[model samples]
Target: MSLDYDLVIIGNSLEASYAAVKAAKLRARVALVLGETETNTYTEIDRSTFNCLTYLDKKGQNLTQWELNYDFVTHLNSSQIQTWITQVKQDIKEYYSPAILADLGIDIIGESGEFCRLPALGFVIKNRTLRSRNYLLAMGSISSIPKIEGLSELGYLTLETLDLENLPYDLIILSQTPIGIELAQSLNHLGKKVTLVVEDSNILPQEDAEAVQLIQAQLEAEGIKLLVNCPITQVRKIEDKKWIQAGNEALETDEIILITKPTPNIKGLNLEGVKVEVQPQQIIVNDKLQTTNPKIYACGSIIGGYSLSNLAKYEANIVIKNAIFYSIFQVNYHPLPFHIFTHPILSRVGLTETQARQSYGDDIIIIKQNYKTLAKAQILDETTGFCKIITRRNGIILGGHIIGNNSDELINFIALSIKNNIKIQQFSQLFPSYYTISEILFQISENWQYQKLQENKFLNNWLETLLFWRRRWKL
Candidate 1:
């Protein structure tokens, strides 16, 4: 059967546009179907607001705690940010102009898309019907609004549709992700009474116990009320405020914000018409980013497992190889570090301790080192969390978890170590520069050896074996 385009991407997600570029680069006839009707909300924030600028005091280490009057929020102009986002969106569209893409043997579709099978396996977007050999579904996801009894009827705040100018006196944040927790604390620091509600037993359901415990402590210390393992039974308006019935407790709040997991955006695509298998929450995709149907491929929110834009782009490349080139490129989800951008960030690489125990049994070695022990942390007065590294009984590193000032960046080294099959004993030699957050990695690695020496001769035995082999590398 003849096809209109070689590759067709549906949806306006950044990943969708990026996949179009990748496909065009690979010398394929690409067509992107997107709705330019609505403003792109994801990139609405100014780039400068994201760049971290730290204020240093005497001796050049102590962080200056500045908010309202001196923080980045003080400089945020809603109108300017919106303008920038609009400009960026236009830039993306123009950069991949039809004329430019035509030179690369690609086409374009600017409308809503749906799959049809009657005439042929194709996408019908408004007036134009496009037939493609393969389809890359980079359609992003929507906010997972839980099935609260009266939530739909009585309106609530979502991260996407939040109004910053209209501040509520007391806010109830129903959340399940780290972004929710970060917002809770951040809004609290902004002088709002905030209560965070988590359906799970603890904050960060997927994080290590130690990281969770530390973050939970810090959240409480920051005066953010946590209602853990508690979900709303009913929501209704009580004159000026909103009343919530949550697990035998009644609470009243000025407004409610939902920060839940992202539900896949596969609606109206008529996926069932094409025999594509989709879960209630997400579309089922294999490691290679291929859907249940060989001709259909997916990434981004539809595939689930990730919420970050970068992860979606990574998945998009995998789909390009598997769907376009007929090559196998799998995602190593584990050893993929994640960070919650809270004041004291929470980050983890590889498996959680619970996950490690489940996979390797109870024989896995565990070592924990606190940022409080580091002079750099003391100098900065940012000693609120610790780093925990897990390894095998024979000295192979398994996983790492960090919750501290620089936990976000610190987790990367641990992730690389796990990815490269580097062991804990070898980490001590991987020293970072003096008086830095990275030194914690080297200290923890040295501590791992000490712990092993006290508990077992695991480190010594590995060293003896290395000496016996006399294996030396010329680096």
Candidate 2:
């Protein structure tokens, strides 16, 4: 069969739309299959709303310091919040409108479709068959629902379907994921009593334990109830009130939210016919981002890791190249940084301390600097966390975990060092401006140098002898 296009991207996800636009820009004949359902749009909007609300709430406390006499109320009425949501939705729609995409030479298919295998592999939607040299699966993710008895009957809220404008007074959120924690914090700040239930021993199990503990502490300090290592056994609705049997405690709340790891939306696409292997949570792909069927490639939330659009776009870049041309390029996530957008953001890149120890043994070095020590942090009155840099004994930066104001920005410096194979010692040579948060990097590098000096007894003795000789000669 003659190919209909060079690439056929399946799904209406932001990642899919982005790939389509990029492929078109590359001058490849691209067709975007936007199914009836909308994916990731609402989730993105909710995330943006969370960030905006958090920023306003934090800034409200410093109104007097800024010499502003206005009282800042971060809370918005239901209709006002809905209006904001509508405007955001409209803006996103305009940005990715089919008409705009068509101008770039992309075929926009609005109907839902499934993969067909018998009559030469192609996607079938109504009367049309979208045949291409390569297929890209960019289907977005859906919230993973647990198998708790009575929970399905109770019908909990997911991030995509959450009604922030009409949030309940009390919430029992069942999740340990970063998005879950972010939502819990945002809702708590909005005057909602949030009880965050984590099935794991700690939140963000992949992150540094100390940093995770600090975030937990911050949440608790803000009156958010946190239940670690506690799993919900059952949930039942009782006369407009919901009761949850979590671990040993039976907690009552007005609503329950499930914010577990997201599952990819691959149903009805007939991936089995196309020989695509899929786990319960993600689609299986190789380093080249190719599915089991080499002709098919997948990216974004479907392949699974974190539902970060920037990471997804990075993957899309690699996928587009290999799909349109020879499959030589592979996706690299080592340099990319991810962060939870909570107050005193928890951002990280590269390996954690445990991973470094597992890989390099005890020969590695760990350097920590408190945010409170930074003049910028003190001046900003936002010194609630610290930065931990994990490095090899030779000072090669392996990873960085930070929990503090602008941690999202600070982590990038470490990410760049790791990406470029730059040593931690080089950070000391950098001259950051006075009273800046970036000084933490210099302090951490110096701390590493000081640690090495302390550990080197021979060097210490040499310094002591030189000092004594110089004193005796009065030089």
Candidate 3:
């Protein structure tokens, strides 16, 4: 039996569609198993709304405190925002539509399918069998709602089912992920009293503590109650009000939102039958991203962790190389950056301070710089965060954590540096535009140099001796 496609991507998520289009552009015979498309329409709207709120917040205009029913910054109400979101969603659907994809030389099959090991390995959808040389699973994950007493019957909202038009006055959010932190802030800005309950000791345990604290303080200042290390024991609906018993506290709210961990969408895929190792939350894959069955590969949310689009795309690129050709490419997430879209956004790359210290011991150096010290931050009145960089004694950047305005863009500079194995010394020689936020990197690098010099007593003495000789010579 001849192979029908070089690659058959399973799932209708944006990541799956993107992989299909990329494979097609590479001239590979690709087919997309289009199920109900998982559009990120609301996510984009929420981000846009947050940006508007951010502008007002920076302007020192407490719109929420003003009790403004309408967003003066965007000049739009909730109903108008929904209308715009619908149009945007329509546009996105058309862009990734089966017709458009088919025109791009991607065989878009609008049917759900499952892997079959018999009659040769292939995916079966209705009467048709898709036999591909290799298969890629980009099936995105779903919000893994926690198992709490009376929660299912009490009714709650997840990101997938959130309604922006009908937001509650008070809400309880159960999560510890970046999305959870972001939602808490965004909703708080929109005049909703948000109580964030986290099961972990700290939010973003993977990031630098100092950077995370800055964001945490900002959230508290904005009046969003944070209940760390609090696990929900039960949920109940007392008449029209919702009551949550988390840890030692019993909280009341108008609604409850769950942004818990994501469970991979592999239930109907028959992965076990196909000999693909499956975990409760993720699919097991090797460094090469090859599943237990080498003929099949998986990426995106199904692999677990953050489920970031950027990280998924990175894995997808590696999968493409291995599937399309005999390549030894393995996915490396060390240089990849992840960010939270809070007011003073948090972005980080590579190992955090604790991780670096654990691996490198006390030989690692920590460099810190404040956003307020930068002229750019002062001019913009957005100086509420700092940058923390961890490097080996040799100046090799082990990690970088930034919390401030434009940290998302700034962290990329460090990510690119780390990817190219560029040392922190290289940044010291850089002359970023004087009145730019990027100057913060240059300043941080200089601090690293000063710290190194301070650690070298002999060099410091030699510099002092040289200055004394120059003074005595009186040239």
Best by TM-score: 2
| Candidate 3 wrongly placed segments (more than 4 Å) | 36-76, 86-95
Candidate 1 lDDT over 1-475, as tens digits, reads 7777778888777778788888888887888877544323333121213212211111122223332243323333334434654576577667656567556666656667789988678888777788888998876777777888988988898866876557677999988777777777756655579999888887877788777887888889879888898878999888877899877778899999998777777768899998899986688877787777778898876676646666677788888887777757888777678776666777777888888899999789888888898888988677878888889988777888888877777888888888888888887786778789888878877877677677667778887788777755421
TM accuracy, model 1: 0.84
The best-first sequence of candidates by TM-score reads 2, 3, 1
Q: Which candidate gets the maximum lDDT versus the true structure?
A: 2
The model with the greater TM-score, 1 or 2, is: 2
Report clash pairs, candidate 3.
Answer: none
lDDT to native, each model: 0.74, 0.86, 0.83
Q: After superposition, how far is residue 301 of candidate 3 from its true place, in Å?
A: 1.2
Q: 421-463 in candidate 2: lDDT tens per residue?
A: 9999999999799988899999999989999999999999999
If scored against the real structure, what TM-score would every candidate get?
0.84, 0.93, 0.92
For model 3, how does the per-residue alpha-carbon lDDT over 316-371 read when each residue is reduced to its tens digit? 88988899887589988999998878788888999988899889999899888999
What is the number of residue pairs that collide in model 1? 0
Worst 10 residues of 1 by lDDT: 50-59
lDDT at 377 for candidate 1? 94
TM-score of 3: 0.92
